[model samples]
Target: MEASPARRPHRLDPAGGCPHAVNARLLARGAVTPVELPGGIEGMAVLGHAALKEFLQHPEVAKNQRHFTALREGRIAAGWPLLTFATVQGMTTADGDDHRRLRSLAGRAFTPRRVEELRPRIERLVAELLDGLERAAEAGGGVADLRRHLALPLPMSVISELLGVDVEFRDRLHHLSSVVVATDTGPADAVAANRELVAVLGEIVAAKAARPGGDLTSALIAARDEGGDRLSHQELIGTLLLMIVAGHETTLNLITNAVRALCAHPGQLDLVRAGRASWADVVEETLRWDSPVSYFPFRYPVRDITVDGTLIPAGTPVLAGYSAAGRDPAAHGADAGRFDVTRPARPGSVRHLSLGHGTHYCLGAPLARLEATVALERLFTRFPGLGLGVPEAGLTPHAGFVGNSVHALPVLLRR
Candidate 1:
């Protein structure tokens, strides 16, 4: 049955966190469909390519929590798993001038020049990680979980090094961050994770303030504004948390998804081998094929808003259905479901909103693209015969609606 109404959105894929499945169901209903969040929370999902792009740039909507009436009125109870997205003071939850202010400060470390400069370091890191992967395969008799051996560590190390997050805190933060993003996390654990995430980041910010270094954390700490415009203590910690989670998690999955896609569709890898496509094509296609972030959370409408006849009540969180938009058949054509490295770009529109659009666009996008591209090129070159060690069905989706990726990807370095 179709969604009854925006007030009672159709139930989405709760047991399985497959975006394509969810997208297919929601897309069949309409461009904008109301859906139920994990905690019995009602929200709207924009799953169409055209409609999602429009709403992402919609002037009527804002991501700031102040506009969320349910939250402000305490209707959204404490310990809700989705509260982190709503209560976090980072740019992800900020809108308007506040967003601009926060984004401006964080953007300094991720400029084209800065991101390009990291290319050399990233290459070195990729090389080292490949060595680790080789060791893992040797120990495992030519089998390895690439996600654990390579994909996860690459971005985690890069972001941690860039932000100067200590190695000691990396694993701790990763565990906490995983819980914070996963929808299926239990209420009590979710609340504890959110609180501990803030506490951990607060310690990082405090350390940076005491003895600053030539790192993003120190730079953000030192950034000041005339007329009392500055990143407050809470905002500073939130920014660090945002950088760690957004910077690492998104790119980790991007690399993982790209590798998974290429391995699953070896013909696409053959195309790259025949000079029909480049690693850049692989990266972009993977993004369009299996977007890392599935349903980016919590863009609230200041007033009741209607998109293509579906009404999203004011103050209800609107999840951006990015993974759905990536594979929308309407905009991408009937063959959209098939992964094509040579897929033609849709004219007059941005390639895809995987990295988002307009003002709230991801600040670390360049870095992410660079990391994925370099990592893929080096990985494929280093392990020419790499293939999945397990059946396709063996790959399991993470138990979270917001993040779309398999929990683990096992592969054979050589068959």
Candidate 2:
């Protein structure tokens, strides 16, 4: 008889600790027990580089789910919509062959070449935003909320341009995206928002179809019409929704986190300001120090499997803590938690699960990097004496999900 196929590992009780707690210990000991969720069978199995590499590259694991019953029910109780526009039309929930096809189509528009071509435009947007920030500081006695003025709008503006959506409508769309992501909102509210967004997207799609332009929306419409790769109405709508939400929300967090990290670490900030250190390193370290997308939800074993000697049954829900992995001492040594931009690059120098791994790796990784790098460079260059106007403790952290964001990042643009 042929040998049996290898089984995926599982961990029972999996370090009965919150992801942050587990990460603290991991940063000290180089490894720890896998972290489980409030409900058993749903938690991240904290692993070192070796295990993480295996887990991320594993073919058996899948991130797509038809509906997040637990998350949905939670949202319903909070009074949000059952299926927000994003849940109904986003591509992250797609799996297997359908996922592959959709990703391939979107990949064309997200290519490195396309993103590079948009660099000058992104820089221009940054310059415009900074000008507003400068005005806000001068008007507000040298202090302004960077989150409101820069971090939030920068990505939203870029995404709007990419999707061919009206930037003037960002506030409305941002409200819908918030409802879609907020667990505090009840299902009904979320459902309503989803419906409204879908309707809006439908109109945009129809308009683009009739008068195609040179935007991603037009590209998608063209593919559906002239190209052989015809996309269903739902796919087109969902893909567009995903692009708007994922493209902006995640990038927003990234910019906010980078700014916050630098403020908290003055030495690092000085390095960035002086131009003595590469902005690339600063960005990478910031990403590892406090990754924007904290934990991502993924499905558990498809069959009974053992992970590091623990057995987990099939159909379980698990969340992998990418933030926890980035701070793991085993991977980054004793100073894993330190924000050091001058740290030399090693074999795994810039390794962090921030962009995720395996088949679910973020496709917007390059663009996000470009946006952050350009935005930071422009901001610091324009406002060399930029400093937090509010007390660090006064900053309000964004609740829910793995996003490390503060509601307002007040900075004094005194150059």
Which candidate has the top score in lDDT?
Answer: 1
Per-residue lDDT tens digits for candidate 2, residues 1-415, read 2323333333322112124554575434332244433233234453454455556655655545433444534532333222342144345666678778778878876788988988999999999998898889889998998988888888888888888887557788877776666434445675687778788888888878788788889888776766554577777988888788788888888888888888778788887667778788877887777777655555445555555444434454555556777777767778877888887655854467788776767888888999999998888777777788988878776755435566678987867
lDDT of 1 by residue, 140-213 (tens): 98888999988899999999999999898999999999899877777789888988988898788778778889
lDDT of each: 0.86, 0.68
Instruction: List where candidate 1 sits over 4 angstroms from the true fold.
Output: 1-8, 13-16, 224-227
In order of appearance, the predictions have TM-scores of 0.96, 0.84
Q: Give per-model CA RMSD.
A: 2.3, 5.3
